[model samples]
Target: MVETDKPKQHRSRVLEGMAHAVSQKGYGDTTIADIVREASVSRRTFYEHFSSKAECLVALYEAASHNSLKVLRDAIDPAHEWQTQVERALAAYLGSMQANPVLVRTLFIEILHLGPEGLAARRRVNSVVADFILSMVNGSKGPKSHVLSSGMATAIVGGINELVLEYIEQDKVKYLDELVQPASDLVHAITRT
Candidate 1:
């Protein structure tokens, strides 16, 4: 393998290892040793990517969240009806989360164990999601006077996250798709006002 690609590959493996260990043993019980073992990389290599388990988990949280957001982003079609776009995007986002039950639990539930650091990582991702919602709502084919403010967008993201957290907590991650319609309704309801 190329030298540059090797580091990235190791980092990715470590991240996956963290996710795997967290999913199996929960973040509280998982150790750096477990991560390296699952990742098939050396402890030195793990440190090269992450300083501690919390950092590794946070990175995994961010990576998984970004991937889900990408699904939401790609599902949007500006040319379609605004309501349709919202529904599709919501469905796609939930579908992406449902696709990986392990991440659904580890990223949504376990990350919070990191306290402030976890919250900050979650806030950063939520802000990006809010921005995406802003673009979709403001750029939609709706009333000229109707504008979805950043605060409301943030609130919507939080609400959706709460719904996801509930599902993960209940071990119903596979049923996350059930939230799409209600979540989409919320965006429509708020944006219309």
Candidate 2:
């Protein structure tokens, strides 16, 4: 029987190496050889782990998003007010993005240059974020606005995503807290009946 655990472990190492390589070279420019070389594995090993560079990028994106979601959830206390929770979540996401700027850059910008597979992966990430925001707003303290809910949630998520992209582009995360209120306000405005 094939050793499943060995393949899983090798795939993980390849993913880490791809993240490192892309963080330096970017997604559009990175090649299979670049990944395998940085990973210190042979071409066959790279193929064994991933079918293409796009797959590696998608895996990298999934890993980063998963980690950021955990950080965001941990940043808020369950007992806090809805707005406070929003602020905490935003702060956590921005903070994590700032800390791992390379990951954010590669996942957002570089992934865009790839084929349909990468785009689909990005859409999946966006859908996950959208769903999370929807759940949070729907569960907020006060009454919910069914009519504006979807647009409001999309706006909130899009705004935060753009702000994070800007932070990564500028190489600075100054005034992350300042962004929270405006983001919250935008959400409120959009959702208010």
Question: Please, what is the TM-score per model?
Answer: 0.94, 0.82
Question: What C-alpha lDDT, on a 0 to 100 scale, does residue 167 get in candidate 2?
Answer: 61
| Candidate 2 collision pairs | none
Put down candidate 1 lDDT per residue, 152-176, tens digits, no spaces. Answer: 9999988888888888878788899
Candidate 1 TM-score, true structure as reference: 0.94
Error of 1 at 22 (Å): 0.4
lDDT for model 2, on a 0 to 1 scale? 0.73
Please report, in order, the local distance difference test score of every candidate based on alpha carbons: 0.86, 0.73
| Residue lDDT tens for model 2, 1-193 | 3687878777877887888888888776788888888877888998876788887788888888888878877876667655556666776776677677657677667777776877787778777877777766677665566644665566667777787667667765554555666766676676662
Distance (Å) between predicted and true CA of 30, model 2? 1.3
